[model samples]
Target: MPSTVPDSLDGWWCDSSTEYAFVGFSYEVTACQSRSTLNSEFKDIRETFDGRYVRLYGACDRTGFYDDVIDAAWNNGLGVHALIWFGFEGGSEWKDRRDNLIDTLWNNPKAKFVTRAVQFGSEPLYDYVLDPSDLAGNIWEFKWNIEDLGIPVTISELAYGYQVRGGAQIVLDSIDVLDAHILPYFSQTASTGDAAWKDVNNDLNWFIDHAAGRKIWFSQNGWPSTHYSGVEPNSPDAVADVDNEERYYKLLESKCEFFKSVAGGGVGWFWHIYADWQEPGYGLYAESGKTKFDFKPRTEC
Candidate 1:
């Protein structure tokens, strides 16, 4: 539990933890990439990163999207935790959208077979459109509705939403596991990647102390590589930069055992993204195929 990070930036952390980390990433289900490219992407994840699953963020309503991505995962021997993204602050439309996806899944055999879980929403409570209790009620509703298909239901929010936000505990029975998002950069409490890892560990420990009966999964978690102009994160006291992102990757490898320990508030995390896109650019691989850091996760960790 002491600092695994090197004392100076001149050295990198060595990962000796023997525990196999059940890693994952959020991959874009885009038609822009050729079928071979898609296949290669999933192949790299399973072989290169030892990934067990992938998180699909959007396009759940489309039948084609499911057909495409699920097949890719299946071919690569990976399962998927598909998402129903209601990326909004307020809306009654999400209810209809949720039902539409259920309808989509109910009809599709591949989706039913390859899908491990269906996350109802991303940060609905954190966005404040729905209160914690109301959000929990929605998740409960979704859980039972998808029961016949045998897919577990959950919601993605900050861990604080489950712990501090009111009435979130009421929905525990309805969910298979808690898919909370953890971003210490956004928390603004830590100044460096080492501190951020400690912050994350402390947060997970808090979950162990408080939410003792629940299995927590950080379905969305990562540090940004850069802002708009290739500078540091837009904060005076923050460390959301390439250096910290690289540092975070090292720490992740070093603490693989701690992360995957099922009994110790362990979480299955999907690094928030595989590459940069529209905004808040948290890309491991950039637009021009440039890697922000040469993050070979398991190799020589």
Candidate 2:
């Protein structure tokens, strides 16, 4: 693999082609998805959404990992934000998983070429798999292991994760970019109803202020399209319906430029999931491969 990336994320992620401000989505790949399916999916994202990147999970699929994901992304001209998902399992196995992926990357030259960045683990700190200091160590280890790769390194975390225990300065100080998964649905502000868009901006401003001068990029942010009911544990206003989802996207339209501006925040953002069939809910594309709403530059992700 070449040690240098030709079009590295040197400044900030940008895409003048899209009518939408968001540049990417969090797509989880699976073994059942064929090469053509992967190709079609990546092609659809680029052509349909004018999307420039995707934050990928499930690289370590239980059946077996797919190298085709990177190939499809490169073929579609979209950067891949690769990840080592440390899902809630608080065990020493996380380190082994990290090392295994590093070894895999060393063998897969295509991965190094198309990688936008190497995310050590998504929400490890948030999941309590590792505390701030331990997570920071893992980040540094991954950074050091891939030093020759010339890629930026980071970990995905909720905004409040950094503030845990009066701020996880060790972990916060480790990343090249502050990769966050800020969603209003999980916050108290979701009870505010029709003003969900305002909540998103307020949450955004909170990140901008607390970014510690590092570049900030939202790795995941989207409302669930599924409506709620009394049976659901969440309050009546907490669950998002189709109407609320549409409102959130539409209201966010005016602020797209600001969100993409380096002076405004630092980096671009990504919608949570790509398809409902793959992960269920939170998808721009429904189970039938149809769009769930009238969102532009993306009727479906």
Best by TM-score: 2
What digit string (tens of lDDT, one per residue) describes model 2 on residues 211-293? 76666677877777675443232445675666666666665565665655644334567877898776666788888889888
**Model 1, 58: alpha-carbon shift in Å?**
4.1
Tally clashing residue pairs in candidate 2: 0
- Candidate 2 Cα errors over 4 Å, as ranges: 1-20, 30-32, 62-66, 192-194, 227-235, 262-265, 298-301
Every model's TM-score: 0.80, 0.84
Off by over 4 Å in 1: 1-22, 29-37, 58-63, 228-235, 262-265, 278-280, 299-301
RMSD to native for every prediction?
A: 9.8, 4.4
> Each candidate: what lDDT?
0.65, 0.69
Worst 10 residues of 2 by lDDT: 11-20
Q: Can you give the lDDT of residue 245 in candidate 2?
A: 62
Question: Candidate 1: minimum summed lDDT over ten consecutive residues — where?
Answer: 9-18
